[model samples]
Structures are given as C-alpha cells and as structure tokens.
Target: MANHRAAWTDERAEQVIGELLRVGVILSVVVILIGAVFYFLHHPAARANYRTFHSEPDDLRSIARIAAGAVKLRPREFIQFGLLLLLFTPVARVAFSVFAFAAERDRTYVIVTLIVLGILISSIVGHI
Candidate 1:
C-alpha cells in the first residue's frame, strides 16, 4: 500500500509539473502574440531595422523600463516582457520541482534540485 501510494504521488507530481510547463509556454506565446499585434497596429509603416542589428533601446533593456513601458501599452516592452516570461519558465519549473521533491521527503532530489535552481538563478543574474 505504501508503495502504491508513493507511485500515485509521483505520477500526480509528474502530471502537475507537465501541466505547469504547458501552461507557461502557452501563456508566453499568447503574451508575445498580443505584443506583436500592438506593435503592428502602432507601427504600421515601420520597417524591420535588422540590418544594423543594434541593441534594443534603453526602454527595452531593463525590467524596470520594460514594466514601465508595458504600463503605457508599448508593444516592444510587451514583447520584451513576454520574452522574459519565456526565459523564466524553466527556472519556475525547477523551482516547482524543488518544492515537490521536498514535499516527497526526497532529500537527495531536493538538494540536487536546489543546486540546479541556484545555478539557474546565478546564470540569470551573473552578468549583473
């Protein structure tokens, strides 16, 4: 009975994790699409200035700027925010996995997950 219960718990955890990932990806795509729509609506005549390949403008560089721009319904910021969400999805997944492993009293897995989470977060902020 204990074995069966553990198996059931594991299966449920996997399902929940899978759902989390699917939802995250779908939400990211939706937000990005909405941003694209806003961009096209506001910049109907703007051409792709990809030849220069310059960095995004100051307003699109930082999260603070992006959030402020998003409040003003700026499409580039919306797209940038969406991209941020996309970037954080896997980090969120690892975060969830850490909690899930802790809940299961799986100390080894929990530690490993925490290490992975730490590395991921470090990578994100390492440059800063």
Candidate 2:
C-alpha cells in the first residue's frame, strides 16, 4: 500500500486528471450526439416554427427533472444533461486537486483548492 501510494506522484496525478477531463468531454459529446439522433428519429420531418418565440418545456426547469427526463431518454433533456456534465468537468478537476494535495500533505494547496472548488460549486448552484 505504501509503495503504491509513493508511486502516485504529481506527474501521475496530473496525467490522471487530464484524462478525466478528456474523458468527461468525450462522454458529454457522445451523450449529446445520442440525444440528437434520438431527437431526429422522433421528429424526422419536423420544422422549426419561426412565427413566435417558444420556451423550454416546464419539465426541464430543474436538475432533478432534467435527470429524470434523461433517464427516460427524452432528447432535449438528455442533451441538457450532457451539457451540464461538460460544465462540471473542470470543477471535478479542482475537486481532485484538493484530494491530491491532501495526499501530499500540502495544506496550503489543499486549502486553496478547496476554496476554488467551493466557488465553482456555488457559482453553479446559486442560479439553480
């Protein structure tokens, strides 16, 4: 256990976090694309009505509802969930930074990274 912990160096942590970001983005894209395909499949010949402005459905007004819609494979909600995932990718990196710093016994960095993580979360949650 100690040997494995020692092997988890800064470079390794960075590489893992980088991969997290890349995979997150790729997964978001795949989700969005899948939703788009589903949307088109259901509305192959549908055309946009430009006569009046339309708002998003009431069911997509909250994260819980969006998640529920996504679980049910609703197209717009699924795409919105994908976009929400993309938005949180960087936030996840910052959160991992706190863990990495804690593992290294770097209190200063852990504190700073925690502040950054808090701000990121608040900024996202405040408007919601």
Candidate 3:
C-alpha cells in the first residue's frame, strides 16, 4: 500500500511539472512574437530616421550634434524603448532555461522557469 501511494504521488508531480513546462514554452513564444512586432513597428523607423539625418559624421562637430540629438529623445520614446528591452529579458531567460533543461534534463530548470515567470508577471502587473 505504501509503495503504491508513493508511485501515485510521483506520477502526479511529474504531470504537474509537465504542464508547467508547456505553459512556460507557450508564454515564451507569445512574448517573442509580441517583441518582434513591436521592434519592426517602432525601432526600425527611428533608426532609419537617425541614419538619414546623420550620414557618416566625418568630423567631431557632426558627431557631437548627433549625440546631442540622440540624448534629447522624448519621454514617451524613452519609455517605449525601455519597455521593448524589458519585454525581451524574460523571453530570453526562458529560452536559456529551456536550453539548459534540454541539455541536461535537470530538475533545476523547473525552478528557474517558475522564478522567471514570477518576475515577468510581477513586472507586468506592478508597472500597470
């Protein structure tokens, strides 16, 4: 009876861990897709505009002016850039954790995934 109960508990734990891993994979995919859309929509245009105005900047004065203009970004633009980078960090962490898990098949990855998810969720909720 004791052996049967222990086996059932072990099986249940495995099922729960599997479900968590699936959720982590799905969340990571969604985060990456959203980040890609945002980067294409936002950063590429700004970079193009900056390139158009600055060109090669062959001298010190031109470089100074470009630097000054870059530093003069609007508050909203800064926030958008920060948010884009912030969004990528967790996705990257999850990708690394997945790789770590696949390479070693270690249980430590389950804890790492949970920590990353907790941090991401807290940041999203606290910021809003």
Which pairs clash (backbone N, Cα, C closer than 3 Å) in model 2? none
- Writing each residue's lDDT as its tens digit, candidate 2 over 23-111 gives 99999999999999999998899998888868777777677888889999998899898988898899888988888888777899989
Please report the TM-score between candidate 2 and the true structure: 0.85
| 6-109 per-residue lDDT for model 3 (tens digits) | 34343455565566566656665554465456556655555434535654333222323333432454333333434444455546556555544544555686
Report the candidate with higher lDDT, 1 versus 3.
Answer: 1
Reference-based lDDT, each prediction? 0.84, 0.87, 0.50
Query: Which is the winner by TM-score between candidate 1 and candidate 3?
Result: 1
Worst 10 residues of 1 by lDDT: 1-10
Candidate closest to the true structure, highest TM-score: 1
- Candidate 1 residue-wise lDDT at 79: 88
Q: Pick the lDDT winner.
A: 2
lDDT, residue 80, model 2: 90
Of 1 and 2, the candidate ranking higher by lDDT:
2
Task: Give the residue spans of candidate 1 off by over 4 A.
Answer: 1-8, 126-128
- Candidate 1: which pairs clash? none
lDDT per residue (tens digit) for residues 1-128 in model 1: 66743553566788988998898899989989999999999999998668777786788877678878888889999988888788888898899888788778899999999999999988767332
